[model samples]
Each structure stands twice: as structure tokens, then as C-alpha cells.
Target: MEHRIATFLSRLSRTWLAAAVLAAVAIASATPAPAQDFITVASTTSTEQSGLFKHLLPEFKKATGIEARVVAVGTGQALDMGRKGDADVVFVHDKVAEEKFLAEGFGVKRLEVMYNDFIIVGPKNDPAGAKGKDVVEALKKIAGTSTPFTSRADKSGTHAAELRYWKLAGFDPPKGAWYRETGSGMGPTLNTASGMNAYALTDRGTWLSFKNRGELVILVEGDTKLFNQYGVMLVNPAKHPHVKKDSGQKFVDWVVSPAGQAAIAAYKIDGEQLFFPNAKP
Candidate 1:
């Protein structure tokens, strides 16, 4: 009789233990998961097409547990997004536009991050006699010869720079049957250039990563005026109270930091470094 009672108590205890385990699991299943930390960055298409963010964001996430969501567009659009408080950070290659954004109180601060030169790519056959000319001089020749040239007329930094060169070349917004404005990003404009065997101005980073070259080759480069400078800024929290100030500043700081500069410098294609880090001390 005592042994029977002992077995019944043991079974009862086992049943209660099983019931407790089931209750714990049900409670755990109903609990919500912790929200992930993330920030949105408005940046230029060159960084996205060049695969720079793909190479850098993973490292950033691993280091800070903050996911960076990038909206890659032309510099004009990127700055517009910042002005509208759609992004926490803006990373773009247009210093003048960025300064204007800051002056308008859309961005709090601007820091020069990295640089790469722009190059004018055209047919290797050199139909326009523009080969080996200085970048501005090349534009002059293309305008003079009326050679087919593609332009990203989306008000991007590239487009703005192309306009500057045209202005210097005595052609303000060169318009002709030969000048084609695609109103697209760098990569797509390059694709247009490649398709029509036309000349197009492009940042070196995009040109290095671009693989759709049909007859296009670098016809003009190495001009100091071709320098392409990139900058990063935090959206003004004063204007956009919802802006992720801390997180955005963190990204801006890290990008100019030695570690972030190293990551940018390390990105290469076919043994050619795409961007050179020159963040001010």
C-alpha cells in the first residue's frame, strides 16, 4: 500500500511538471520580439551601383547592431529627401548642393568623406577627335563635332558637373541632336551611352563597377577639374524632430572615422581602388 501511494505521488508530480512546461512555452510564444534598430540614408546612386553600401553596411551592422537602409537616387533627390525629413542621413557626392541643403536648415553639418575623379567615356574609335583632351576640352570638342553624347539630366551631381563643364566650354546646357539627356542615373546613362556609342561623363567609381560597356572607353580623365568629392550629413533634427539624430550622427562619425575610411579604401575591382578617402582630420 505504501509503495502504491509513492508511485501515485510521483506520477502526479510528473504531470504537474509537464503542465508547467507547456504553460511556459505558450507564454513565450505570445511575447513580442525585440524591435531592431535601423536608420535610413539618402545617398547617390553611384554608391549603390558601385556596391559600396553592400560591402560596408554589413560591417556596420555587425559593429553597431544598427541597420542602415539606403535610398539611392540622384544627389538632388537625396537632398530633397533630407529636406522632407524622409531620411536620417544624406551621403552624396555634391558639395555645393549639400552646402545649399545645410544653408536651408535641412542638414545640420557636412563633412567631406571621399573622392574619385570623373571621366568622359566614348567609343574607342574616337569619332569625335575627343580622345586625350582635358575633360573640359573634351566636352568642347564633343559639342563642336556634334558627336552623340549621353547626359544624366536628372539634376544629379554628375549632371551638375557636366553642366559646369559645358558652361566652361562655352555651351550652357549644350542642346543639340547629338546631346541626349536620359534624365536617369549614372549607370543607366552609361548604358545609354554604351548603346548609342556615345560619350558620357561619369564618376570613376561607377565606371569601374559598370560592366555594360559595348564600345565605350575612357577618353578623358586625369583632369583636376574632374575631381568628384563625396560628403555625408545628418538631417537637421531641429527641422525634422523625428529625425534619428543619434543614429544618423553615429553613421556620419563612423564614415569619417579611420575604420570607415579603411572600409571605403578597401573596396576594389580588378585591382583598381574605386574611391580614395580624404576625410578631414
Candidate 2:
């Protein structure tokens, strides 16, 4: 009886140990794993609207195993987000603003990423007679005729370029019905112009990818002033200690790298390339 009792005790001990191990395993299996590596990038609406991020970020993730999450806004807002330490990196156009951001110590440095030109898109009827004309002359005509012009007015790179053209044209567009401000992004502004049969300035990439173009057509292009250059930079870790510096720098380096440039060059719509890779080695 004593031997039988000892045997039964040993079996019970073994069973208890096994049950404890199984319970631990079940608890671990039920628990969630930590998040994967990721970095936040504040970029322009044109990049998002053109679907460049969708095409580019996946490849970046596949290559480096680091996910890039983008917040698409105007260049000004993107820089603002960097200033507030809400972003790990920034990618935007508008060289003047980018330079100012670097000078203000918001970013480590600016690296040119790509380039595209802006074009004047207008109604097919060409009421303002802007087609094939010089861009400044086209703006002047649009302003002079008070032809319905849709402005992004969102402090975007495209809006900045439009303001520069207006200044060069020697006039300030007043608040009126003919000159409408969308206070929105590039894609919506283009859509509004299309819907209203008005004129708007848009980057070539967004213009190419935009499918809602109602009666609008490219009216003016090929001006040297219309050149749009995009830049990338890591947010200053000194200002934002919480920033993912390593991940952000990796993203910047990858974007300017040869493989990244090739990837950017590879993205196309309907057999036409969008952004041209102009990053220097």
C-alpha cells in the first residue's frame, strides 16, 4: 500500500507540472506581441495623391524591414509637424521653406530627393487663352480676365509656387468669386477645378495620376520657374529626443540611395513616369 501511494503521488506531481507548463504556454500564446519597427514621415500631399508613397514604401519595407508611415500634408504643415517633434522625418518640396527649416535647426540637413515640374491646367474651352502661353503670361491673363481660378491656398509647395508666379506676374489676386481658395490639398483642388471648369496649378505627378479631370487640360508648362524639387531630412533629435533617429536616418539614406532612386524612377501610371530621381550621390 505504501509503494502504491508513492506511485500515485509521483503521477500526480508529474501531472501538476505538466498542467503548469501547458498553462504558461497558453497564456503566452494568448498575449499579443510588441509592434514592429516603424518610423513616421511627414510628407506633401502631392506625393501621397500621386500614389508614390504607396509604391515606394512597400519596397523600402521589404528591403530594410522598417515600415515607413507617412502623414501627407502641405510642406508648411509637414515642417511644422517636425518642429513640434510629431514626426521622425520630413519629405517636402519648396526649397526656400526647406532651407529655412534647416537653418532654424528643425532638421539635421536637407537632401534633394526628386524633381518634377508644375503645369497650369485649365478648361478645354480655354476661356483665358492660356494654352501654350508662357506661364507668367498665362497667370497674368487668368488674373486679368478674372477667369475662375482654383487655388489650393493651403500653404503647400504648389501654393507657394502659385504665389511666386502671381508675384512675378505683378498682381495680387483679390478676394472675389472668380478667385476661389480651397484651403485643401492638391488632389482636391484639382478636382474642384475640374468640377468647376476652372484653372489650377498642379505638380506633374499629381496631374498625371489624377483621374477626375473633367474638362481640364494642361494649358501651360516648360517654364524654368515651374521646376519642383523635393527634399528629405531627418528631424533634429536634439529638439525632439523621442525621435527615432536611426530609423529616420536610414529612411533618408535609403531614399537618396541608388536602389531607392531606381525605385522612384520605376513608378509610373499609364506608361508615363511621375517623379524624376535627382538625388546626388
Candidate 3:
């Protein structure tokens, strides 16, 4: 009888041990793994609106196993974010502003990542009667007339370029009246221009993604002043030492590397290359 009791006790102990082991296994399996570090990127709305990020970031993530959190704003705002150490990196297309940022030590070496020209989009009617003319002359015509025109005025790289073009054209557009300052991003500004049947300057990429709007044709292009170049810069780690240096460097390296350049070149929308890789220098 004692032997029988001993056997039963041993069996119960085994069952309890098995149950404990299974519970521990279940608890271990239920625990989630730590998330990978993310690189915060502040970039121009044009790049985001053009669907380039949507098409390109997945490949980057797959290649590097690092997640990218992108914040798309106007060039000016993006720069501001970088200056505040709010972003690990920035991708913007304004040459003058980019130079200023580098000189100010807000960011480190700027890498020329891509190039795309801006286009003056307006109604097919061409109400301002400016088409097929030099960009400066076209702006003069647009400003001279009271015809509705939209300006992103968000201090975007596009805005900076537009202001430079206007200054070159020798016309100072008034704040109110015919000139409308839409303190918005590229996509919204484009939609506003379409809704108001006004003229707007837009990057080729954003123009390509913009749809569900009136027929706003590319009225003026092929202007030398309209040429746009994009640059990627790492936020100066000295200013914000907490900034992830390794991840930031990796992003910069990937952007300028041959493989990354090829990826940029391969990205397309509606059979149009939104950005041409210009990583040299």
C-alpha cells in the first residue's frame, strides 16, 4: 500500500512539474521583444507627396533593418526642425538655404542626393497669359496681373526659390490682394491652387502625385532658375549629443552609397523619375 501511495505521489509531482514548465513557456512566448531603434527624418513635403517615401522606404527598411520615421514638412520647417535637434537627419532641396544651414553649423556635411526641376502649373486657359516664356518673365506677367496665384509661403524651399525668382524678375509681390500666401504644405497648396483656379509653382514629383483636381497644366518649365537640387544632412551631433550618431551616419552612408543612389534612380511614378541621383560631392 505504501508503494502504491508513493507511486501516486510521484505521478502527481510529475504532472505539477509539467504544468509549471508549460506555464513558464507560455509566459516566455507571450513576452514581446524590444522594438528596434528608429531614425527620425525630416524632409520636404514634395518628396513625401510624390509618393517616393512610400515606394522607397520599404526597401531601405528591408536592407538595413532600421525603421525610419519621416516627418514631411516644407523645406524651411524641416530645416527648423533640424536646427532644434528635433530630427536626426534632413532631406531638403533648397541650395541657398542648405548652404546657410551648413555654414551656421546646424548640420554636418551636406550630400547632394538628387535633382529635379520645378514647374509652373496653372490653368489650361493660362489666364495670366504666361506660357512657354522664361520663368522670370512668366512671374513678372503673373505678378503684374491680378489673376489669382497661390504661394506656399510656408518658407519652404520652393517658397525660397520662388522669392528668388521674383526678386530676379524685379517685382515685389504684395502680401495681400492678388498674391495668396497659403501657409500650408505642398499638397494642400496645390489643391488650393486648383480649387481657386490659380497658378502655383510645384516640384515635378508633387505635381505628378497630385490628382482629383482641375486641369492645371504645367505652364512653364525648362527654366535654368527652376532647377532644384536636393541635399541630405546629418544633424550636428555636437549640438545635440544625444542624437543617435550611428543611425544617422548609416542613413547618410546609405543615401550616398551606390546602392542607395540606384534605389533613388529606380523609383518611378507614372513612368517619371521623380529624383535623379546626384550623390557625387
Candidate 4:
């Protein structure tokens, strides 16, 4: 009887050990791995709307095995995200704001990534008679004639550029039915302008990718002031210790690299290049 009891006790111990081992294994398997291989990038809606991130990020991941999750907002919002340490990197088009970010120690450095000019899009009928005119003069006509111009008053890089043009044109656009502010992104603002049969200033890239153009055409372009430049920078790790510095820097380096530049140069809509890669690395 004693020998049988001892044997039973040994078997029970083995069973308990096996159960403990299985529980440990289950816990280990259920635990998630660290997500250090991915980084968050705050960028402009123009990049997202133009479909550049879709084309560029895949190649970046394939080459580096690091995933870049993009948060598409306006340039101002993007920079603000960097300032608040909400983003690992910033890719935006507003040079003044980008410079300000760098100067304020929010970003490590600003590197020019690409460029696309802004164009005045209007109805084919050209009610404002802005077609084939200088952009400033076009705004003046739109304001003077009160011909239903849609302004992206969302404080985006495009919006900043538009305000600059208005300042140069020497008139604060009258706040009324004629000057409509669509506190939205480029694509939506363009769609609003299209639906209203109004005029809007838009980046050429978004204009090219837009499909709901409905009688809208590029009314004004080729002016030097319409030139738009995009920049990229890693959020300062010194400011935000939680920032994924290595992964963010890798993405920044990859974008300005030859392969990345090639990818940017390769993306086109209907065989027309949208963004020109002019990264001065």
C-alpha cells in the first residue's frame, strides 16, 4: 500500500510539471514582440492624395525591412505633430514652417525631397477670366470679380502658399460668398471647387491624380511663384526620447537615397510625372 501511494505521488508531480510547462509556453507564445521595426511619419495630404506614399513606402520596406506608417495631414499639422512628439518624422512642403521647426529644435534637419508646382484650377468656361494669366493676377481677378473661388483655409502648406500669393497681390481677400474657405485637404477642397464650379489653387500632383475633375482645367500655371518644394526630417530624439530614432533616420535616409529618388521619379499618372525628385542630399 505504501509503495503504491508513493508511485501515485510521483506521477502527480510529473503531471503538474507538464501542466506548468504548457502554461509557460502558452504565455510566451501569446506575448507580442516589440514593435521597434516600424516608424510613424507625419506628412502632407498632397503626398497621400498623389499616391506617392503608396508607391514609395513599399519599396522602402522591401529594401530596409522597416515599415513606415504614414499619417497624412497638412504641412502645418505635420510640423505640429513633430513639435509635440506625436510623429517620428515629418514630410511636408512648407519651407518656412519646416525651417522654423528645425530652428526650434523640434527636428534634426530639413532635407529637400521633391517638388511640384501649384496650379490654379478653374472651370472650362473660366468665368473669372483667370485662364492664361499670372497666378497673382488670377487671384486678383477672382477676388475682384467675386467669381466663387474656393480657398483651402485649413492652414496647409498649400494654404500657406495661397496666402502668400494673396499677400503679394496686395489685397486681403474679402470674406464673403465669393471667397469660400473649405477647411479641408487638397483633394476635398478640389472636389468642393469642382462641385461649386469655382476656382482653386492646387498642387499639380493632386490635380493629376484627381478623377472627379468635372469640367475643371488647369487655368493658371508656369509662374515661378507657383513653385512648391517638399522637405523631410526626422523628429528630434533629444526632444522626444520615445521617438524611434534609428528607424526614423533610416526612412529619412532611404527617401533621399538614389533608389528612393528613382522611385519618386518613376511614379506618374497617365505617363505624366507628378513629382520631380530634386533631393539635395
Q: Candidate 3: lDDT over CA atoms? A: 0.88
TM-score of each: 0.89, 0.92, 0.88, 0.97
lDDT of 4 by residue, 74-107 (tens): 9999999999999999999999999999999999
**Deviation in angstroms for 1 in model 2?**
8.6
- Model 2 lDDT at residue 102: 97
Judged by whole-model lDDT over C-alpha atoms, candidate 1 comes out at 0.93
Tens-place lDDT per residue, model 3, 107-161, is: 9898899899999999899988889849998988887787788999999999998
Candidate 1 lDDT by residue in tens digits, 156-207? 8988999999999999879889999999999999999999999999998999
Give the Cα lDDT of each candidate.
0.93, 0.94, 0.88, 0.93
Order of candidates by TM-score, top first? Answer: 4, 2, 1, 3
Q: After superposition, how far is residue 273 of candidate 3 from its true place, in Å?
A: 1.4
| TM-score, cand. 4 vs. native | 0.97
The residue pairs that clash in candidate 3, if any, are none
- Candidate topping TM-score: 4
Tens digits of lDDT, candidate 2, 1-281: 99999999999999999999999999999999998999999999999999999999999998899999999999999999999999999999999999999999999989999999999999999999988748899988888898999999999888998998988898664456899999999999998999999999999999999999999999999989889999999999999999999989999999999989999999999999999999998
